[model samples]
Structure formats: structure tokens, C-alpha cells
Target chain A: MKICVTATAEGLESSVDPHFGRCVYFLIVDDGSMDFESVPNESFSASGGAGIQAAQQVLNKGIDVLITGSLGPNAFPLISSENIEIYECATGSVSEAIASYKNGSLGRIEASNSPGKQGGKQRNGSSQKNN
Target chain B: MKIAIASGKGGTGKTTIAVNLAISLGNAQLLDCDVEEPNCNLFLRHDMEEFEDVTLPVPLVDKEKCDLCGDCANFCQYNAIASLPSGVMVFPKLCHGCGGCALVCPENAITENTRSIGIIERSADWSHVDLWQGLLHIGEPMASPVIHQLQEHISEDNNVAIIDSPPGTACPVIASLSGMDYCILVTEPTPFGLHDLKLAVDVVRQLGIPFGVLINRSDIGDSRVEEYCVSENIPILMKVPNNREIAVLYSKGIPFVTSLPGWNNRFVHMFANICEQLSTRAAE
Candidate 1:
């Protein structure tokens, strides 16, 4: 199962990048195994649809799982639409997030916690309702 | 004369230079074309008098009269429309709103729908300068449309119109710089600054616009920017030293030329030089 991993802002631990806005790092893992390659999310400038483009990359790669500290409302729906399962509130290193997923220690977040304004609720998988 | 201040990278002091130049010129029109994050208004502090909503036409499909023939999707350059097995889907963000898709639809299924992308604001006083700013709503993908709306306010009779462009050499920057007499590229003296400066120069050259460089925070970085300017024969119009006073004034929403004395004269001289060059070009 391919996985997309994002670290929490508070859990960055390492030095932060000034150019890219408020991102720790993003990791895309394959097959739910330890084999994973880091995809640099720093290229997403705040002005452009960098975040949306990055999510498109993950979709194109057919990532099945997304392991992240916190997923913003903008990113959450894009991934969920592709039928990718989201595991939220997971923190620590990229390795730990994966390990938690494998061991089933990662708690199953209900679709209710899906990170939209309406109590994590979303209409139609596209999120175009707000637009 | 219309002047556009732009840079290939962010944090290069494009706003700083544009705001100061507009203030110094006294009878100028200032345009902030950086719709995504227009910081020039923060410094100008003008009471915004006019606000106009900027909209883009996205294709609205009427499925009733339609056979899902998918011609609309084929004609769209942005791939904004998708023909699924069920019906047509529109990705509003990706839509360029060229209306080509609507024109190509044989069944008359697609029509134009207005979507609000941003707003254009104008503020002016008889004693001071006029300020026009574009504010792109957050999550809006298109900025060029709003920039175009901001440009509509530029009066030909105005003595000077100074535009603060968005960062990067992109479509929005192109839209902002279009029809301008001169472009002043603000860049730092650092390696990254030099790298992006070359990009900005290439963009201006491609647009066939006259451009010069203003090296901001010039004291900190290496001489590469200067060397490149000399080698390329690109004029370095002015050098703003890295100073704490400038920073303090900027944070306090004060124009550096006004809050910090003596800088106004330098800006005046710079504007005179720009005017002289423009007049010479017109004469030739």
C-alpha cells in the first residue's frame, strides 16, 4: 500500500525551511512496508497551487494511505477522493508513522474527522461546494 | 509613464521600492498587482474608496439540453472539464475561462458562469497619490484576471503609474508588466537573488520592455550581483543598504523616504533619471 506522510508543525524537531511556508516534510511510502522515499514538499510556494499540485502527485502515484500529524481541510479532501485512507493524529519520525500503521496501532479515524468546516464533514468528494 | 517593479523571487523588496518611489513622486498612481499577498497597502495606509469584485467566467454546463458528447473537454486548454461516464465535471480552479469551451459546445450545453476570484480596490486623495490594489481571495488559483482588473484603473493622463508586481516570472507577472514603459527589478545581492534576477531579466527582455535593477540590502551579499550587472550592461539604478532604521520604519507602516529623512532626495533623483531616459526614448 502506498502511503503519504506529513509531519506536524510542532513535531518538526529539525531546522525549518524558510522558503516553503510552514511545512516540515512529506514522505510517500509504498506497500505499507519500510521502503519509503521522501518527497520534498518545499517546492510548493505559497502563492501558486503548490499544495494542490503536490496532492495531485500523490494521487498519480496511487498512494493508498496518508500518514500525517495534521491534515489541513484543503489537502484532506483531495486525498480522500482518490479512495486513499487517511490516518491522522500520527506523529514522530516517518518510520514511526509507518510502523504504527503496520501494527494497527494507528487508530482508525472515522470519516467524521475528515477535516472540513462542518464537523469534519464533506459534500461530494470534490469540495467544490465552497467555491 | 508607467513603471512596473517586479522580481523573480519573493522578499526582494519589490514592495519597499514601489511604495517609496510612489510616495516620492508625489503625483503618481501606485498599483499593487501582487494579488495573492498585497503588502503595499500595509505601507501606504490610504483609506480605500473603491472596491470592485473581480470575476472569471467558468463554463457552466446545462445537462438538460446536452448529450455528454465531451467536445467541451476536448477544446479546453486547461483540462478544466472532464467527461465522466455519468456527466461533465468542472474543475473551477483549473479553468482559464477563455470561453473557447463554451464556443465549441455544439449542443449549447455549456454557458458562462461568473466566479469571484478577487477584488480590486482604489484609494486616492487630491493632496497625495492614488493607489489601486488587487487582492486575490485565498484558495483562488487564478491571479492574472485580478491583475488585469487592477490595470483598468490606470489613467493615461496620470503623470506616473508605478506597479508593484507579484513575485516570480509567471503569467501574473506578465499581465502586470504588460504595456508598462519601464520595469524596475528589485533584487538582493545574494546568490539566490542573482539567480532569480537573471530569470526576471530574461522575462523582461522577452517582453521587450526596458528594465533596470535596484539592489536592495546591497551591503550584505557578495559582489556577484554587481559583477553580473556590469557584465550584462544592466544598469544598477540604486543601492539600498541593509539598515535597521529601514526595517523599523517598514514595520511601522511608514514610507522609508518619509520616516527616514534624506532618502527622499535620492528617490527624487532616481525618478528624474527614469523620466529623462523615457523622454529620450520617446524622442528617438
Candidate 2:
């Protein structure tokens, strides 16, 4: 299975970026061999709809699962179409987040973290300040 | 000729300048394009009449014909259309009404529908000034459509029109200030005011409109704003000083010109000066 983790920096030691759509890097990892591809989020600085754009990019890549902090309302619909599972990873490094996912510690996000059309840090509900 | 009074920051006195100037120069039209929080009507005290409805075309999809190809979703830059496995979803609030989704659909299932977001109100001011203002519905993000509706009320016989533009150098400001003959850039002297004033100046300059600064509450803050204006060679058209009585009267919903005596003539003279400056530039 392919897993996409939001990362703040390049390589495995980078901490998991709390914001999914606007993250600096998306680490697309092959769960079987632990091999990864760092796809820099081109839509990170979009004036609006960055979440949906990022989700589209990951979906096009055939990512089976998304491991990130939270999903925005705009991105929720984009990722949900393919039945791609989304897991909430609120803390730890990208490697640690991947490890937790392997151990079945991360919880599946059924509903979008953001309640409405509002996005990013302003998103309420499942989104936390610490992460 | 149309003149727009715009400021990047709120509370910089756009309405104060607009209302006073309209009263000062008789037989002019005043357009309050600030649909979100229109306050021109507050001082005008005229019984407003709804004239027209402002609507924009948004797309609606026919579910039976749609194959869930997701082409519309890919075409929409705003992500207003989402093609889920179950069906297609359209978020009207997020849609910019660009009409691209309908064009990109191969099945020709998308159809146009008008969504009314705002309306225009008109009121006559004692046969001297005509007031036209746009009022956007609450929770409506798009404001330009209503502003455009208000602009449609401008008639050929109307010689002078003063547009009270909304605050901020965003889409709303651009919508009101676009194609204006001249813009009276209103600003205060404070640091925050000066910072946003520069942004407003940049916008006017980029649009290639002839603009001059009108400093309201000039006596309170430092002289950096004046110095910047002088250095940039942008003329200072008028200076309305900071006065306690003016604020008190304004708070009571009384226009300063109505209570403050000599301000009426001062605004009239300012209007004359604006006409002279604009004509002089045109001649050159």
C-alpha cells in the first residue's frame, strides 16, 4: 500500500507538518519496502483552494492512504472519491507517523477536520494548535 | 465625470468625504459601493427604493447525463465542483461563476442558473443629489456583482458622480475604482494608515488612474504620510483636521457639514480644485 505523509522538510527525520494541503513536502512511501518519494507541494502557496489542489496531486499519484494532521472541507471531497483511506497523525516525525500507522495506532478520519468551507489554521474540530 | 473615494484601511473616512462632497456639490450622484457595510444612507436620510436585483450565473449539473468523469472538477480552479464516486457535488458559495465547468463538460449536462446575491437601492436627495447604493446579502463572499449593479444606475445626464468605495485593496475596491476618471485616496496620518495607504497608492498607480491624497484626521498622527506624499509628487488635495466635535456629531449620525458650518464651502472648493486639477492634467 502507498502512504502519503505531510512533511515539513526533506528526508525521513522531518517532522510531520500539521497542515495537510499546505505542507512543504509530501512523502509518498511504499509501505512494503519503506522506499519514499519526496513530492514538493507545488500548491503550498496558492491564494485559495490549496487543499483541494494538493489532494488532487496525491490522488493522481495513486496514493492508497493519506497520513496527515487533518483534512480541509475543500480537500475532503477530492480525496474521498477514490476510497483512499485518510488517517490522522497529529504529532511526531514522518518516520514515527509511518511507524504508528504500521502499528494501527493512527485513527481513520471519517469526517473532515474543518466544519465548512474554511481552511488551514482556522479549521476547527479535529485540528489542534500543538500539532 | 466619476470620482471614487477609496482607502485601504477601514475607518479612514471614505463615507464622510463622499457624503460631504456630494452635499457640497449639488446635483451630483453618490454611489455607495460598499455593499457589505454601506453607511452612506445613514447620513443621507432619504427613503431608499429598491431598483434592481444583482445576480450571477452559476452552473447546475444534470445527474442522469453526468458520467462522473470528474472533468468539471479538474477544470474548476476554485474546487467548487467535486465529482465523488457516488455523484457530483457543487458548492455554490465557492463558485466564482466563471462558467468554465459547463464548457469543459463533454456530456453537455451542466446548465446555467442565476443566483441573486444583492440588490441596488436608489433615493433622491432634495433634487440636488441622487443616492444609489448596493446591498449584498449577509454571508455573501462575492461583492463585485452588486457594485456593478450600482454602477449601471449612473446616467449620461449625471455630470458628477462620487463613488464611495469599500475599504481594503481587494476585489471590491477594484470593482468600484476601476475605470474611474479620478480617485481621491483617503488616509489618516497614523503608522497603520500610512502602511495601507501605500498599498492603495500602488493599486491606483497600477490601474493608471489619476489620483491625489485627501488626509483625514491630519493633526493626530506624525508627519510621515505628508512627507511621503510630497516625495512621491502626488498632490495633497485636501486636509480635514482631527476635531472632537466632528467625531461627536458623526457618532450621532449627523454629517459634519450639516452641523459644522464652513465645511460645506470647503468641500465645494475641494470639488472645484479636483475639477481644475483633472482638467489641467487632461490639457497637458
Best by lDDT: 2
Q: Model 1 reaches what TM-score against the true structure?
A: 0.71
Clashes of 1: 1
Reference-based lDDT, residue B142, model 1: 69
Give me the overall lDDT of model 1: 0.74
Task: Note the chain A TM-score of all models in turn.
Answer: 0.62, 0.86
Best by DockQ: 2
lDDT tens per residue, model 1, B60-150: 9998977878788667655466554356667787787889988989998888999988888888554567888898888766678899889
lDDT of 1 at B222: 99
Which stretches in model 1 have alpha-carbon errors above 4 Å?
A1-131, B124-126
Clashing pairs in 2: none
The number of clashing residue pairs in each candidate reads 1, 0
A2-96: candidate 1 lDDT, tens digit per residue: 77676433232322222111245566667534565666564244333333444555555667787654444444455566667867544356666
Best by TM-score: 2
Candidate DockQ values, in order, are 0.05, 0.17
Alpha-carbon TM-score of each model against the true structure:
0.71, 0.87
User: Which ten residues in a row are the worst by lDDT in model 2 chain B?
Assistant: B79-88
